[model samples]
Target: MGILLRHIFILIIIGCSLSVTVIKTGWSEDLLFFTEQYPPYNFTGPNGKVSGISTEIVQEIMKRTGFAYRLKLTPWKRAYELTLSQKNTCLFTTGRTTERENLFKWITPLTENPIVLFARPTSTIKIMQLSDLSEYRIGGYLGDAAVDYLVTRNIPVETVRDDKLNVRKLQGGRIDLWVTGEMAGQALADKTGHDIKKIFTLTAIAGGIACNLHLSNLITTRLQQELNTLYQEGFIDRIYQKYNPDLPVPVYKTK
Candidate 1:
């Protein structure tokens, strides 16, 4: 009886060790994802799962490269933290910025998005340079990079919880300019009854899929290489066209 009991205990230990090994290997684990709506990028579908350009790219990366992952859409700040905190975690369509460079291992050149400054039709503000933004009050997404750039350079600005509110405030004559992603701005302007027009194209911002720094470089490079191959084959463009019919997909190259 004692011998049988000891053998059973050994079997349980062996089984538990294999389970831990499999989970750690990412072969038997459901990986975690972090994202926010940067649109035509990541967002929640009507069925409450992930759906967007970022989601599409990530799905292909997982399928083609055999990485297992699942996505969760949350606000940007929390998504950023969650992605940075977990193993086998990633955030998508995220702007590859100097501020966040060290926080994640990158799979970059995902998409090129234009960040622009917008103004109401009634306003005739012309922006020739970033410095010109200081002339009037500006509004944008609370944690948006443009606002961060301006504020870091000592340019005074206002932040709204989201871009929709910025349009409303602009329409209400509360702000002279708003910074936003061009694709999103155009779509949003068309959707909402706002007479927002681009003051100037700020710059072409590069966004990508990134994993927490704790994730192995092997995993990061695997996805990056697969995406590069997809880009060369024009598959990324095929996915982008699904989100916005008129959008012109940019060519990807590694620096």
Candidate 2:
């Protein structure tokens, strides 16, 4: 009986020690990084590996921080939900909005995207302001920030699970306007061979890594600082230029 009690005590000590080690490591086992298939930002490459501008930047950050992570490409809605519910989970290319300000710990801005209203070349719609879009049939992607923005303003939006479908909807005259990132829309149009044109720029968004609120402030601060350094040292510019050589790099400001 004495020997069995001693062994049980030893096991308890070992378990406690492992718990402390995990706590000190910040991420449990490995960090969970989630993203969707947004081309030019993050998408599966020809080799089946996740590759894109934002993916490269995130890879560099992980390399610099010496952190082990598991990257998964999932639906944006599932990724967003996991980031909100799980600890030490992160979702990338998330737009920073006033409504979402306190929901997650924002690490760093990965890209600056102009949210625009797109219409078919032959469409006769014109959007001078937010209110002007109310009359038109607006198509938005599910779990996108643009949809929430429109909904909050009392504008009716037709949401689909896949953003690519919006392009088809607009082309077929199913929806009058498509709200999405300008570059994202262009990339989709290029892929589908559609001639979608930007109708108006709704707003410019700084999208970045949004970690679960349970994430340690220390880890978030460290990442933010490292990303700022990368931007200032022009490493971010180099990565962006590699993917978009024809376009001028936008200046990144750390907030």
The best candidate by lDDT is 2
Model 2 C-alpha RMSD to native:
5.4
Model 2 / residue 218 / CA error / Å:
2.2
Which ranges in model 1 have alpha carbons more than 4 Å from their true place?
A: 1-28, 45-49
The prediction achieving the highest TM-score against the true structure is 2
Residue-by-residue lDDT tens digits, candidate 1, 1-255: 999999999999999999788655754566677777666677666897778887887888788977677777777767777788888788877777787788788887777788888888767788898777767888878766666666767887788766778888888888888887887777677768767788798777788887888776667778888888888887888887777767657667664
Clashes of each: 0, 0
TM-scores of all predicted structures: 0.83, 0.88
1-255 in candidate 2: lDDT tens per residue?
999999999999999999888767775458889999888889889999999888888888888987778899999998999999998799988988888889999976788878889999987787788888767899999989878778877888999999999999999999999999888888998999999888899887788899999988767887888888888999988998889875435567656
User: What is the lDDT for 18 in model 1?
Assistant: 91
> Which parts of model 2 have CA positions greater than 4 angstroms off?
1-23, 246-250
